[model samples]
Target: MRSTSSFFHFLIQKCNRKTRRKLKFSKELLVVDSTKIIVGIGQLPWAPLKGTRAGVKLNVAFHPSVGQPHRVIQSTGNHHDFRSSEELFDAAIINVADRAYAKCKRFDEYV
Candidate 1:
């Protein structure tokens, strides 16, 4: 089994796709969202969420055109989407993001 930490990295390296050199982000959207799998608060105190809930966050960034998820970065429930994701901006392709990724400073740099 592959390590969870390097799972995404392994896919990018071995996935059957030319993500680079022909990335067309106009048809691709960097959809970002997190799902919570609530767990026992006392059992896994490390994964804290709203109120007394506790769980981990599954943060995903994908290219719909390529039919492959470019990134799947995980974080504790409390972590914000924008801060946890990579700087997903490319001059050659369009980068669409939601309100969570509305960082002016980062956007300026990306542009």
Candidate 2:
């Protein structure tokens, strides 16, 4: 099996290339969301108390046009979904996102 970093790198490159080539003007829509994974550090100095722990976030960019996920991205735990929107989809592409991504700047710039 390939290393985790290598696999993710390949995925990112493939997604970027695909998005650049075929993400043209269409009546399609894309959705984005993130999932969190917790990691235990065994009482590290910077660890959160009680319930919280170090974690990784999986930020996904899904094309709802086909009723299946098209592309996905994984980011650090602290990265917000909107902060990576531009990198997830091509510029000016139509995207359908939840209220968390309804910022005016992103809508004005990429919608």
Question: Top model by lDDT, which number?
Answer: 1
Which candidate has the top score in TM-score?
Answer: 1
Tens digits of lDDT, candidate 1, 1-111: 877437644544543346633563233344444555688788669887767779887766666557666667777877777776464443344455567766778768866
TM-scores of all candidate predictions against the true structure: 0.59, 0.55
Model 1 / residue 88 / CA error / Å: 5.2
Q: Candidate 2's error at 108, in angstroms?
A: 3.4
Clashing pairs in 2: none
Worst 10 residues of 2 by lDDT: 41-50
Q: Write the per-residue lDDT of candidate 2 for residues 69-111, one digit (tens) a residue.
A: 6667776666677776666664445565567655787557644
